[model samples]
Target chain A: MTRATLLTITAPTGTPAEGDAGFALADFDAPQVRITDLSVTRGDGVFETIAVIDGHPQALEPHLARLAHSAQLLDLPEPAAAVWREAVAAGVRDYRERNGEAGSGELFAKLIYTRGVEGSGRPSGWIFVDEGEDFSAQRRGIRVVTLDRGLRHDVAESAPWLLAGAKTLSYAVNRAAQREAVRRGADDVIFLSSDGYALEGPTSNVILLADGVVRTPQTDQGILAGTTQAAVFAFFEERGLATEYREITADELRDADALWLVSSVRMAAPVTDLDGREYPVDAELTAELNRYLLSRTE
Target chain B: MTRATLLTITAPTGTPAEGDAGFALADFDAPQVRITDLSVTRGDGVFETIAVIDGHPQALEPHLARLAHSAQLLDLPEPAAAVWREAVAAGVRDYRERNGEAGSGELFAKLIYTRGVEGSGRPSGWIFVDEGEDFSAQRRGIRVVTLDRGLRHDVAESAPWLLAGAKTLSYAVNRAAQREAVRRGADDVIFLSSDGYALEGPTSNVILLADGVVRTPQTDQGILAGTTQAAVFAFFEERGLATEYREITADELRDADALWLVSSVRMAAPVTDLDGREYPVDAELTAELNRYLLSRTE
Candidate 1:
């Protein structure tokens, strides 16, 4: 398998003037980030990961929009969307050409935009595409636990500095929650707002099915607006399953008819169990959703 | 007059047993970190910054202990204290050697320990020292503002995954809060817990003097145990003032007779104003305290 490909945006915050390439290919294995980059020093940055199926990057625009939204939340400069989009396309093309166009391996493109080296006003951006991990087992089913996120649901409005809705590089707590889930013998986690409402997972959005209606926790409660979740809802809508984005309490989540954690890289990971409570998986429907997700070209 | 000095720990998590050289000098201006380093991607790491004055690194042991403490909070493997300590010494030695030994610059050494490149399973460590910013004005006095931290004071106890107390690299919120302070036309910020208790500053600890007692927000409330704060307390105790660690509320902080934000690099910055309300600066006492802090050889 070919290793990952890397591209560094020469101008991350705006369009490149004439004569500026905007981006260039770089060595992926060698070090490319300065120790002083805010992304390394303070976790001061935004990022997006998009899944590529059959050489098509899924939900590219939504991912880019979210990346911009996250940057706005952090008060960072507006990202040069065209430059980043072109970089992703180039990264994918380079990877496919290297791996052979016939190889239809699932890949992921991670976009990183960081506050550059300390004391430098310039921001930094990078994009890299690599073969995705086998989430086959998780796609079919996975176990999860609920953990307290320790912030009130209204904090998003009450305290923007808390950076709740931003998909920032500062994900240590999310990583820790996932580790806590592993400690409890689970594969993932569903975080709860301190006010007793289900928030989102460390890296995924929570989707619940109840009374034939599908619902996911509202993003206004400081949770991310999942790119894959929108598609998941579309999938359900096509199947005549009503979908929603509303606040789902922890208790309501526990009582749901079914549940899944959705994200770009993993698509739809059905939660087979949550907090020791078992939930049956809809194998056929889940497979169809996966097929539908992989079939998307946008 | 010189740029920063850097030392990369060859082995970050253990004793450099059997002549491993433990650490080596690295080019400071070069890119020494990979984009995949968790410190860059996930902010999955811990760090410490210790002040050095006239060749002596202040509170060396306390800084090391706190680094280890922060690491444990993140479930990261125990850091190699001996190796780290030696690296700090080498860094200081290198700086003093290059610059004149008689040059008494206020330098700060930053220790960064991160979960290494993805899937490498190895940790990374580095130490860099540079002349501190000209905080002479801030040391004299500075304006401040209050922002909500969004997490209740008890979350550190109720929710370990929130990672309140750890000195992790996940500082996006802190950076955002600092920017918010700037937007509010203030020099810095003091974050209050959602439940209306004074927490700490984004980068410094809050020390309040009230009713003849010197107080600070308790560390149990998910605040870092400030190495410089301990010295501040000692400064107070020596002058026949009672020092305390208690849950100071927002109103109590406002009512305090005097206040200062203390940290390693900045030393002590007396808050001249809070939310536009003026507070008298004790210039004489502040200078003496800073003098005592700088003169320390331990």
Candidate 2:
């Protein structure tokens, strides 16, 4: 009989998981926390996906800044900066020990922060690390489907008090939307808010095209102002391309010269198809953005 | 120096927390689980609250029946009968161990059924033993505020793909609305669906009075049909009083004869004030309804 090896790490000291004294162990190969312990309460928490580059997290500072902003939106306690830095460092360490360096392909690090524990205040959180898909897919661009199954941006805009831009744990709906898209034989989905407004993609950022200008949803549209989205805007500005962040209707998407889904993993995957309509992939622009992202990380 | 004693519980098998693990524990005091471990992704859970009568959960059967109906709505795996028995047994056990038969006053019991673990394929769930509240405030009635927040009922109705009428985990907005209400010096809130239709209360059942008839928000409004509200309906029906479950407007609430909030904990808390407007408390009907609920529990 073969025995499986386990890797574990002690949960953060102040976390309620630490309250379970018996389950605490000292190791690093397996996760110390188990998924079953989660309850179905409001599931309010903040999370961020960091890129691991050359045994270190790329753009770590910006991710943390967004995480903090999201925590504030959710009314959750902000973990100490040192604690977040340490968690990210630990994840990077694990990645390096297990998979060597960033040259061995890109690693997607996910940091989850939640607070639903007994002693852990209502703002308890967790940080996790993960490796993203290889850049091979983005090398040839990707296909996408526009889905209208999620919340509308306007209603979400009206009720600004809720966790609008925050990366809360109430992500089951988002994940379900992605699953629906994948089920439809597409690589990803760009959610159209309930009112037929083009929102962001399920897990990635969104950018559209209209009348020779690059456009994306306004930040106030309840879409997460993604880090990669910001980088794209910056690149567009530096290159002197007219970048606009405004409300783009589904009708506008049909006439746009090009559309792309941007994220840390893919940098920018030009949309080849949307809602059964196909657009010519902008390979040259995609390569330029990917090169810019890689130049920063490398 | 005196030390404060902290009460905690751990799973019997010392299992680590699992994501999507919804139901399993029957006892809160046996050190089985933590509350925050529950998330909203599990659609197969239902809860009931009853006036603890003689150290026991009241209206256990009806509450169980409603829970079974809810589980069915979410396509839960457990049959109504089995889930009810487990809930009753757990409630009884919890009361016996935590509150004890010798105690007076009142207690509250909650039964939550969740789709346990990601792969169990069978819905996992549980019964929670907790404390109830004092009803002195209800006698005086309450001050409520009105707000139209998040997804309105019509949008939810159109988006039938989203879980409707299931006491699922997506309650962050609901709880936040309640918090906002309390912050504004109101005891509770009556949500106006996006279409300007009056909906239900956050934690309590809704009751509206107009034309000498007692009417509550329709179940089709996508509100969790309150078990206590149902009992009140039955009470009024037997007494030859007019009762209904239908669509109502906020304008209707202003002109209604009386509006009350119902729940297992508070029974029926009358709306004495709404949005700066005051209404006389209906003590006569409240007393009658209280008697009816007590009689049913007995």
Candidate 3:
């Protein structure tokens, strides 16, 4: 498989020249952030990963909007969306030129903006593009375990400093939870708030289908609003399917007719098992949802 | 001020050469980690900051032990302490040889180990040495505000995946708490558990003196074990001063005869105000404690 990485460093004054904007993985070998950069040292940054198909980003507007919200939550300077869009386009163009048309294969386009090195007053922003992998093996199904996120569902309303809904780079706990799930022979983790409310997965949104209705936890419960999940909900609604965003319990999740973890890259992955208990899989629905997600771009 | 930065990268097979062991801030201008590096994308890493005085690192062993503990908590491989020691030595040697003896001026020695670029099977580890500034201005005194950490004191015990005590690179919340404190006209913050128990500061441990006895919160309350605070407690104990480690309340902290935030670099900084309420300042005790900390080395 061919892999490519494109980086465009936006300086304090101007963006990179067009000739200097193409793809190269070797350009990333050297040191980029200062040791004092808060993003590297403290993870004080926000990011978004968009799926690109045929050189077009899926849900570009929504991803940019979410990135802006995350930046606001982090007290970081709002990124210039136009600059990011241009960089993403340049990256996609470079990737296709080098690795051929994306076609069925996809690219993960990432936008990262970090509170730069201390006292420099310049935020370090860049776009990175890489080949997306086939999730068919995972889409065949995944098993997930429930882990305690250790935060009350109502904390985000009162404690904004917790950064509950922001997609900051401070993901050590999430990564550790995923590791714990793998240790328990599961593929992913669904976090439960300390108060027993179902929260979210380590890196994706959790959704359940029951009695012809689709449901997910409310975002006000200190969870990031999932872009892919939003898109899927809209698609389902357009097709005359019922959808609801409300409080979900672990018991309800276990009793659901079907469960799936949704993300931008993987689109939608069916949950075959939960805590060693097998669930009924609706292969037809899963495939249809995947097809809709992969083929639709907004 | 003469500033220097020394980086030593440990490759998959071998470490960098001696000639590449010195300090240069310009060496950090380039990209260090791949965009796919979990350290960059997910903040899946652990780090330590050691204080260096006149080419001698203070409490190096304790810092390394804590770093190992953090790595273990994150399920990362235990870093080779001897290699880190060698790298630190080289950095200090280079700093002193280039910028002359540190004397009273200090150096901040940082050790970082990331999960590395994805799928590379290699961990990115480096030791960075930089000049530390005089914090006499901040150490003279600081104003702090109480903020909710948004977690119960027992959360760490209930959910190990939260990594409450590990000093991972995921410190965005900590940074946000500090920023909020500053916005509230304070210099720092003292985090309180959701249950109203006085926890530690964003980057330091809180210590209070009441009726001639020194006290700090117990580490079991989801707070990092403070290496400097432990050293200070030992020094005070050796001098026949009373000390205790137990649960502390915000009210007790507000009503304390004196309070201080202790850390590796700043040592002990008196907290003059909490939530706009002034506390008594014992200058003689503060100086004596600083003298003991600065004069003693392990």
Candidate 4:
């Protein structure tokens, strides 16, 4: 008798991850399939980047919870948690298998759950995984550009009814701004809203320096509330360093003592420059946050 | 001497063949390796969607011209035109061999020129040919939702940036908005600026109702300016009906006599409903435009 050869890819010892966070190509059969599927095929979806440390995806629960909220805001079906945990665990496993060791460097875990595949004739959803960039710059800090690409802020307040808090993909504009910043010889971009307010970074989280307290845009600014940003803020609160969330103008960012682009991937990187001018950082805070994060990981 | 036989098995075409537009996907065993070989993988890329009609890709010249313009905008190194024409022709020939008879529906030919795929380690551009929606409703019309989905007008005007016009694969937000509308039981969506000013539809073109005149948002409104929308405008002008491009508001749309969603695939479909309210159409004007489009195509 022929033996039944079964290939069983056991579920990893974790939860299924979900988001429009990972990468996929834009190839779909029917164009309308994209409309109906509302999947990532049209390259329109928002995502958040989270860091994986040791054997665990850092801030996994908060990230997943926020992803659910984002999906709901975007009017997509809330993906089951088992699927999300599995997807993320798979990503972590794949990273460990190929890279062989977690090392001191972080492993990036992006949980991409698109709405559907184009012309797949199926209700769309897929979990994708990929490696992320080297965020060593977080330790050393990085240069950035404050670009007046004329993004608007009042639109967020007036049209709070829109997908303000949802991290939907339509990011070609953000990517373009980053490229424009690169063309101007900057490493990253900070988009300036039309009213001269400082918006978020292209892909990183945002924090600013005003007076003495560190402040970032409130959740209502239509910005994706970053898990890392939230985590770091909690860390600050524990340390008794005051932090605030409020509207900030470009002048504030330009004149602040220090500005950090925070994210799960970036952790926190101080911006040393904006446009063509340079801004010096307060070295004490940089070391303080890095130490706090490293200690927490330990 | 033994003759070498060439194997010609069936390939699943992504879309139906029409005007020589069709496509089939081929998987690479080691996608990571192939990406390095294909120069088109550059993340910053541009594309043009051309319609295929009656075994011939209509608007070939215009499509290529637009491709060149998009390439220039992205600073992509353009391959020779002769090479492009030949590549497109080969794609068409392959489609013709498979479909057997002339196709009755619209075919969408997408030419992708990219900077390079991230981590693909390849230098390649991709050509995606697929089919699209059959606008059987153009003979009737469509229902649409006017949504203030947080798009801004000034940002589109002052910067007039590339992402606003370039047909990039980064379309997650546009797709998300459409899905949001769908959940609300609408067929499609038209985005309004945060200020309640009209922008454009998610994928289709835009034409607004007015004092017995058909108007579209100025190209400055960051609309894609569909070829069909242009054709309808030309037809109206030829018939001595006034057509103009200017700013429009949601209130204006509600006050107009009729509205339309236009595209290359659907041609023009009257928007019979906005939000949940019913909108009546002018049977006479709808018929006149339909006749004009048919005659022009013939």
TM-score of each model, in listed order: 0.98, 0.79, 0.94, 0.78
Q: How many backbone clashes does candidate 2 have?
A: 42
Residue pairs that clash (backbone atoms under 3 angstroms), model 1: none
Q: Which candidate order results from sorting by DockQ in descending order?
A: 1, 3, 4, 2
**Candidate 1: which stretches are off by over 4 Å?**
A101-103, B101-103
Give each candidate's interface RMSD in Å.
0.6, 5.4, 1.9, 8.4
- What digit string (tens of lDDT, one per residue) describes model 3 on residues B178-294? 999989999999999888899999999999988788899999988889989998898779888899999988788888988999998888999889999998787888888887777
Better of 2 and 4 by lDDT: 2
- CA shift at B286, candidate 3, in angstroms? 0.4
**Model 1 misses residue A142 by how many Å?**
1.0
Question: Which runs in model 3 stand beyond 4 Å of their true positions?
Answer: A11-31, A101-104, B11-26, B101-104
Q: Which 10 consecutive residues of model 1 chain A have the lowest summed lDDT?
A: A96-105
lDDT of 4 by residue, A19-123 (tens): 432222322111112222223225433344557666567777877788777767655566566656656676556546655543234555554444444444323
Order of all candidates by TM-score, from best down to worst?
1, 3, 2, 4
All models, DockQ values?
0.91, 0.21, 0.67, 0.25
Residue lDDT tens for model 3, A42-78? 8888889999876779989889889989989989887
TM-score of chain B of each: 0.98, 0.79, 0.92, 0.77
Q: List lDDT for all candidates, in order.
A: 0.92, 0.62, 0.82, 0.59
Off by over 4 Å in 2: A1-39, A98-105, A118-122, A133-157, A179-188, A235-240, A264-267, A283-298, B1-84, B102-105, B113-124, B294-298
What does candidate 1's lDDT look like per residue over B226-245, in tens digits? Answer: 99999999999999999999
Per-residue lDDT of B54-157 in model 4, one digit per residue for the tens?
Answer: 54565666667666665555555553454455556555555556555533345555565544434443223444444555566655867778776554665544
lDDT of 1 by residue, A74-181 (tens): 989999888998989999998888888533779999999998988899999999999999999999999999999988998889889999999999999999999899
